[model samples]
Target: MLNWDDISREYQSEIENFQMLNTPDERNVRAFLQNCALELHERQTAVTRLYFDQEDKLVGFFSLHNDLVKVSPSLILEHRWNLITEGLTHFPAIKLHYLGVDARYRKQGVGKYLMEEVRSIAKEISNYSGCNFITVEALHSSLTFYRDRGFKLKDSTAEFHNMLFSLETLDNPTLEATPLISKQKIQEIRDKVMSVIEQSNLTYAQVAATSGLDEIVIEQMEFGTDVDVETLASVCQSLGIRFL
Candidate 1:
């Protein structure tokens, strides 16, 4: 029941007052808002949402963008790809790029509210666009924060862990249903697509020509903008890859 605000100059003063220090990730959130968030928004690299209290002070915030996840074949169960797309090796997904709650807002359900807001946005996008999973690269110290919200770990190294939440599970029963694509399968397909693109060493100009997308759009996609599913599919097709 908290109000949320899109980042803007009107809220600049309040945003400047936001602070955090628990982890490097937390500190980065503050730095991003103070220095880089507005530029990222203007460049279409990410969208940021901020939550504020009744006093009009910033309480928590998060950022989201498009991303790809590579899943190892060994992680997938049987027949999952068939549900998504036939002969597809990778798929597109939404990324929760950054999430942070001010220390003063922790334990007051602010974090949960921010996550629910993210889910709502993802669900809406899936209804019109094509998003199979909501993915995140969570800091090792914050793994439990995501896990409690139904995110599953796909991979882990020392610094961060790749996690995902299937959009299918978030579907509302009252709404029209869509075919469910398992997270593991989507990850597998993403991995394959990226692998193919890397192996081909396709340049941005070549990809723009092949995909029939504007060079600027293609460049933005490379920089993690949340592009429409159609554009992504076109890019994949041009790359001789299938995406679902």
Candidate 2:
């Protein structure tokens, strides 16, 4: 049976050899593995998980990170799930940042297997964290691939589709009872994040440099502007903090 493992030094060689033909996916996989995966993993920016065959060859990989999803009022009304209240505008989620299968394993179920693993991880996180969705920004060509697996488009643009899979669908009673975050709660969390940054003895410029974010955005975040979950995650990673 194929086994899933966290990306580590032991698999570096195999990771270096793994390739996917899809240009964007290929570039991202190679870049992350070659330049950032290890540092990102150590900083808690994102965690890359690998799928290895019986011979221990790395055949595929996916990265997971915390994110926030903004549910449009129309989508909220249409779905009407417990995770989103009429008053709720945004919620935390787990993002599948990148997923790629070796070209040789394309239609042999490796992609599905990785997705199943992602769902399992998301389900486990929901038990302790306030995460409610498993999200992905999929390439245009893979729209049907994700839709067929129960992912619904939360939104879309010319370049990608933002999709979501609600954990509530897993029927975990605890998820049903989880309370929606209030505005006050959001402020409190933001305050805590600022505190972490201050405690780290790092300036906004330093954080921007380390996280690859614009310094002005970090300044705005410090002054209470709303930033996307991905941005917040990058900032947290730079500060050695956990956004979720």
The best candidate by lDDT is 2
lDDT agreement with native, every candidate: 0.70, 0.74
Candidate 2 off by > 4 Å: 172-244
In order of appearance, the predictions have TM-scores of 0.65, 0.65
**Compared with the true structure, what per-residue lDDT tens digits does model 2 show for residues 1-244?**
5788777887778877877653564576567776777778778899988888888778888899999988886775676667546578889999998887887676466877888789999999988889988899877445545665667788777567899987887774322222345556556766777898788787887877687555666776787765444455566677777565
Model 1 TM-score, all chains together:
0.65
Please estimate how well model 2 matches the true structure, expressed as its whole-model Cα lDDT: 0.74
User: Total clashes, candidate 1?
Assistant: 3
Q: Write candidate 1's Cα lDDT for 44-66 as tens digits.
A: 89999888888777899899998
**Candidate 1 ranges beyond 4 A from true positions:** 78-82, 172-244
Clashes of 2: 0
